[model samples]
Target: MRLIAFGESFVAGVGDPDHLGWVGRALAGRRAVTLYNLGVRGATSTKLASLWRREAEARLSDEEPCRIVFSFGVNDTWHAAGEARVTPAQSLLNARAMLTEAASLCPVLLVGPPPIPDAGRQARIEALNENFKLLCARLQVPFIDVFRPLAADGLWVCEAAAWDGAHPGAAGYQRMADLIAAHPLWRAFTLAE
Candidate 1:
């Protein structure tokens, strides 16, 4: 199996001391699979939607089994200079475009963005997560909600707070990975045929 994990820093495993962000930790021991981690530190949904297909296609072949895992939106909700980098409505559009096209190619999963410490930003992240979930359901795509659980999680909150007020450390990443790995859709998507 070939898996392409694309998105922002969380997907890249930024603050984890072990350097095996959720993707590396979650998919560990699956030797039959090769993972391409295409996480950019500050990518937004607009950038990801425009780029994932080209990047994923370069590393894939039609005859091979492959999958795409997209985890974004935290960056989209990022506000600087008195405005969000990308608005919530635009973020949903970007996600829909990516998921719709990716699913047409192969099985795919959408991992909702995790929460950060800022209350204002966290609120936007939560709303975006919910919107993404609804969009996924409408499209019949598999979506995993990481925001609410991690926001309420002590480890994830503290770790993210201490690190960069955004990304978490190893333990937090492990918990996030555990959550995803435990999801039934994730299991079915990754299981060997």
Candidate 2:
């Protein structure tokens, strides 16, 4: 299988000195799969939704089945400019529509944003994540909720774990990779192949 992942810097593996995002880690040593990281920094869901088709078109191939991973949202929350500001619900709706459009061509997975350091920011992130999760269920697409699970242990506050409060470091990305690997959807693809 060939997976094309698209999103913002979080997906780009911005802070990772090794430069391998979750996509690289997920596909490590797997000859059966090739993963593409199309993550760009300073991107919003609107920008990603608007440009995904053009981006994915270039990465897709007929030789193998393709999977698209949608990971975005943190920028939206951070871009709100303040801690208490709530991201508009329409952002999630628009993101869902974008993912749905992509799913029309191939299997799509919705990967919610990671936890943030600010409690207020975390609240908005969680709400957006819940919205994304619900939409994924409605669309019958796979959903990965990384927010609540990561927030449970106050994992985002660790210094070496995730710098800049939003992006995760190598260890944090590894944890996320583990989560995706264990998911039923990931297992189905990895094992059944």
Best by lDDT: 1
Name the regions of candidate 1 deviating beyond 4 angstroms.
none
Model 2, 93-192: lDDT tens digits are 7787887799888888888888877777778788888888888888888888878777775644463334676676787777777777777887764543
lDDT of 1 by residue, 25-55 (tens): 8897788889999999999999998899999
Error of 1 at 171 (Å): 0.5
Tell me the spans in candidate 2 whose CA falls farther than 4 Å from its real position: 79-86, 160-162, 189-193
- Scored against the true structure, residue 4 in model 2 reaches a CA lDDT of 85
Q: Between which residue pairs do clashes occur in model 2?
A: none
Error (Å) of candidate 2 at residue 28 is 1.4
Best by TM-score: 1
Worst ten-residue run, lDDT, model 1? 184-193
**RMSD over all Cα atoms, model 2:** 2.4
